[model samples]
Target: MFTGLVEDRGTVQLLEKNGSAIDLTLEISELITNDAHIGDSVAINGCCLTVVEINSGTLKFQAGAETLEKTNLGLLSQGDQVNIERPLAADGRLGGHFVQGHVDGVGSIKSIDRDGEWITMWFEVPEALSLQMVPKGSVTVDGISLTIVECQPATFSIALIPHTLEVTTLGQKQIGSVVNIETDILGKYVQKLIPLKLDGFNERQ
Candidate 1:
């Protein structure tokens, strides 16, 4: 589990395709790599990737076909910036929300509206993914936990403060930029149970 608080912004150093999978290398700060080791889990752009190799300040991970199909990681280039977060320790505070680093779906920036230093960005996602969101609920975009400001049938909006924009990859995003999105785990569970309950009620009636 992760708290969704971005620890550092890592730069993509390499992306080499080997058959159906791609080997990714990122050069991050010592803040994350100093204590990180092979076999540790890291959240890269909201996707849970295992650390397969650690050399100097760079970490290597492999993305299989399933991960590529479900996330925006495949679109990454050698010089792109990605949000990086380590898993929350058992005694650590949950400053953000519980983030599994599991991308539920891919969303694209539909529009961006700025007011002073704050931003309200709308993302267009699949209807199935939007159904799991609610106003004021928690959502993870590119691994930064944010609250839903408004929820629509096929899109949702989030308010981003200056600190968030400055610290994470959201600052570099533009219209049509693709991002990884993970809806709240609680919302997913509730959504799963509701349909079964409704079906049972209808059968009894």
Candidate 2:
């Protein structure tokens, strides 16, 4: 699992189609490269990808057909900046909420409201995914964990501090830009357990 905390931004070097999979290569800073190894999992734009190779200062990752269909990763081009984060270590501090690096849905920026140093971004969630959002809840957008400022039936907004804008891809986000979103893991579990609990109650009755 990941913590949704971006360690550094990596630049896409190449994207190649290899039959049923896409090979992604990224050039990252030494900080990530020194610790990176083949087979290690890294979260790139909220999608968990396995490192397949590390050669000449570039790390290679593979994305399958399912990932390409479900995430914004397929839209990546050479020179595009992607948020990168290593998986949370067993004893690492939990800087953000639990992020599985599994993109739950793709959301688009509906509007961007700037208030001096603070920017409030409103994203339109899919009808199927909107039910998971709640005001003040945690949501991972392109692998950056943020708190929801407001939640509507089909949309949610989050306030981004200047630091967040400077460090991550949110700085370049514009209206209509697609982003990977992962709703709160706890909320998903609760939703899943509710029906099971209700069924148990009916059986006891």
For each candidate, the alpha-carbon lDDT, in order, equals 0.95, 0.93
Question: What digit string (tens of lDDT, one per residue) describes model 2 on residues 72-97?
Answer: 99899999999999999999999999
Pick out the ten consecutive residues of candidate 2 with the lowest summed lDDT: 125-134
Please give the clash total of every predicted structure, in order. 0, 0
Clashing pairs in 1: none
Expressed as tens digits, the lDDT of each residue in 1-205 for candidate 1 is 9988999999999999988889999999999899898899999999999999999989999999999999999999999999999999999999999899889989999999999999999999999999999999999999999999999999999999999999999999999999999999999999999999999999999
Per-candidate TM equals: 0.97, 0.96
Candidate 2 local accuracy as lDDT? 0.93
Model 2 Cα displacement at 83 (Å)?
0.2
- Model 1 lDDT vs. the true structure? 0.95
